[model samples]
Target: MFVRSLNNESQLLRKIAEGDQHAFKIIYDYHRRAVYARAIFLLKSEVLAEEVLQEVMLKLWQSAGKLTDETNLGAYLTTLTRNRSFQILRRRVLEAKTEIELRKDWTESHNETEEGILLADTQKILADGIALLPPQQKMVYELCRVDGLKYEQAAQCMNLSVETVKSYMKLALRSLRSYMKSHTDLAVILIILKII
Candidate 1:
């Protein structure tokens, strides 16, 4: 019975690969609830789970050509949903941590004139570090980190490959860290910048 089910899925996948919208819809109807349930279980938010479901299904449709006869469709969808949910959770945690750190810094510096001077100095150092980056790296860092763009969006904006954007971002971060370590006494600022 299991083998028969796998065979049926393989047939549907092949049809989907061939651009059969009907086959895609059939598979979507079959799996949408399962995907949504898994996403909700993992993410604990209905809105986010729905978004994940849409994203996962879109990816499935786009990558259908890569599916093979040996693929277990249910397992594949489950894994994708789980991974994406975890990614969102991780991002939310990081954002919360960054916000808390920022709030702590703001509270500490609320009334200290010296803190204002230090912040100005840190900004100058950061500006200098940004100025020193290679042009491509600077663009990537600014787009993805400063402007809050996703890697894919940055790649599109720059007409570069996603991997290249990622590489440039990595290099840019290393350069900034090195510059900060060498020239600044602002360790907390460095940690905050690193989060960005």
Candidate 2:
């Protein structure tokens, strides 16, 4: 029975690589439950698991040409799903840690009203500064800083070199700092810097 299933998967993979939607659908239907189960088990968030399901399947379809006869479909999918889930988990942890640190800094200094006023002023100045950045620099800032994407990921998204992304981020920071300094007091600039 396992042999039969392996042969079936191989044939479907071949058809999928050849861009046969019917065969791809067949395989998706056959394997999606297992993939979703693995994702949900690891992620423990249905929405995030659903996102992983989409990402893994999209990667599968895009890399179908690389699927060899020796590839164990079940193991390959499980590994992919697991890796994606862990990637998301790591990002979440990083974001949460950053948020906690920022809140700690904020709470240590002022009351809630003061914190809110300072945050708003800092955000406005930062927004104005970002608006002044050049196009590539703005994109780099948004991707790397605001979106919390890694430089490599932002480079891939922008189709630029990683070095270029880093350079843009640096320049963007300098420009934002100069702009913020011109617009607000040192304290406001420092608040924005903490968030950045």
lDDT of 1 by residue, 1-196 (tens): 0112434788889898889989989888888888999999989999788778877987898898998888888888988998999999999999999999988777443447866677677777878999999999999999877776778767868999989999999999999888877886665565447453
Candidate 1 stretches greater than 4 Å from native: 1-7, 108-196
Best by lDDT: 2
Clashing pairs in 1: none
Tens-place lDDT digits, model 2, residues 100-169: 9987787455477987988987887788888889999999999888876678668868999989999999
What's model 2's lDDT at 143? 86
Taken over the whole model, the C-alpha lDDT of each candidate is 0.83, 0.83
RMSD of 1: 7.9
Cα deviation of 97, candidate 2, in Å: 8.5
CA RMSD per model (angstroms): 7.9, 6.2
What's the C-alpha lDDT at position 80 in model 1? 90
